[model samples]
Target: MTATTVRAVLFDTFGTVVDWRSGIASAFDTVAARHSSRLDSVHLADAWRRRYAPSMQRITSGDRPYTDLDTLHRENLTSVLAEFELPFETSEADVYDLVHAWHELAPWPDSVPGLHALKAQYTIGPLSNGHTALLLEMAKSAGLPWDLIIGSDLTQAYKPDPAAYLRPAAILGLAPAEVMLVAAHNDDLRAARDSGLATAFVARPLEHGSDQSIDLEAESDWDVVADDIVHLAELLHPRLAR
Candidate 1:
């Protein structure tokens, strides 16, 4: 947890760095426009995200072989589409495009600036459940200045599982304690902390939506807490904040 001991700073991507809901909804709107149809984009975005954890649980539980997040998202989109019963017929290409939207998600306003600040001081990249290809595409699209990518595909594990946190630190040639995880989700931070990594909680109250009720604040006494990614950068590198 000591500042000097930390060597690399990893982040949780989806809700932490990018506004996934808004980005996904915008993508849906574009597709709906393509078909000359009306779709409840926001509702679909929320519904699709709701299935994320459960879809990963099966793989984490060893019920199924570990699958990359892109495939899982595509499969989940099928069910989400079925549940919504879209007014217009959707083709396989449309399904693929909708799933690809995750890669194009826009970062939060402070994400780029804050990440630039951190990258100047430490090795920085994403340690997310997203697979390498997806995370790489997202980083390129979002201009995330990551030094390297450590994804589930590379580790064959997902977050909350100790391996997900531990593997990345090892890959970076650092001990778990030397790698800090910065995330908006309290549970994600808790898991990182439990796996011997230092944790920083960055609040993203609107990650879900304006009415989002959960993860409004740090649920536990994490190593550091801040209002946003820029604030996290400020806390970690006080000299730069000035």
Candidate 2:
């Protein structure tokens, strides 16, 4: 994939740009404080995220219809709550607010600036499983300067799915090869590659808060691999150097 061939970059939002674990842990702590329980916030956050993949798979396999990620998040949160057995009871409002934390997540220090760099040369926005409303709120919350959002909401199918990759190319009026998927997860990059998009892998070592067992680095020599988003931009758009 030549750098010259790429006209747009679609990103995976959660671990790729935002620190979901840290934000979710902080939210859990805040909620725990509300209920006056000394919950281990990080563990709860991990437990909640542990449900993410299987939750999506349920919908992807046609057993459940395509549901937006925000609803999936709420359902996962409710189920994780039962699994964790929160030490104290919380109201429905509290649970909704807890699920809403995804919308309030903080970006990695480089995310916005790196995007600013890339946006100079390419159409850029999320190609994540996150709902459009959720990604929009996150962009507003974190000042992400997106050209436009393209996600599972657009195709009603999550990434790793061919449609999720191809539909964005169609929407942008570009060939799949003309778009690049910038993500921290190798699996995501692999899917993008299979769908004919260029792939750039960026490391997000703390995405799972020190216990991250996977995606610690690029598994394949994708079109590009960089230490982080900023480096990715510099690598792809070397003119940014000046």
Candidate 3:
């Protein structure tokens, strides 16, 4: 598909537009502070995120009915707390607060600016595994200027599932080829492409913290490969170039 054929640009919000690792780590620190315990917040963040895919795998594999991200996160929090062996007992309220942290993630430095730039021309919004409520809260918290949010709650499917990719395109009343999936994960882009959506790869080298090793570069020749969201805007909307 040509550049002009694309009408909407949908982003993978977690690592692509927001810094989940730092945001989650900071949230964990806040929780630990409330308990007056010094926990490895960074490691806790990693552990929590490590459970992300596996939690969804159950539903994606049809082993369980579809569950929203909030419930899955709350469930994963229980497992992570057990694995961490927190010194203090966490009440349900505390668990809910921790789960809510996912909705308070900070955007990448370039995210807001780049989104504004792209918004001048194309439709922009999150097409994420996050639930609609989570994505809406995150967009508001991070100053994300999205046209709309299409979360897993709406589609009832997660990434790598063809439904997740195609459903959003249909919801927007656009053909799959008219939509572009911008992501930091090569696998996600591959899924979008296989589902007939155009793809853009935005490298987020620090997404998994300083030790991140994967998705530092485009593994395949996507429609666009950018250093960051700002670069994505420049690549897609060339008139923004100085």
Deviation (Å) of 114 in candidate 1 = 0.4
**Per-residue alpha-carbon lDDT of candidate 3 for residues 145-201, written as tens digits (9 for 90 to 100):** 999998898999998889999999999999999999999999999999999999999
Q: Which segments of candidate 2 are over 4 A away from where they belong?
A: none
Global lDDT for candidate 2?
0.89
Against the true structure, what is each candidate's TM-score? 0.98, 0.97, 0.98
Clash pairs, model 2 backbone: none
C-alpha RMSD (angstroms) for model 3:
0.9
- Per-residue lDDT of 1-242 in model 2, one digit per residue for the tens? 78889999889898899999999999988988887877889998899998999998887788998998888888898888888777888798788889999999999999988999999998998998987889899999999999998757778888777988999899999999999999999998998999999999999988887776889878888999998888988999899742
Candidate 3 residues lying further than 4 Å off, grouped into runs, are none
Candidates arranged by lDDT, highest first: 1, 3, 2
Candidate whose lDDT is highest? 1
All candidates: CA RMSD in angstroms?
A: 0.8, 1.1, 0.9
**Best candidate, TM-score-wise?**
1
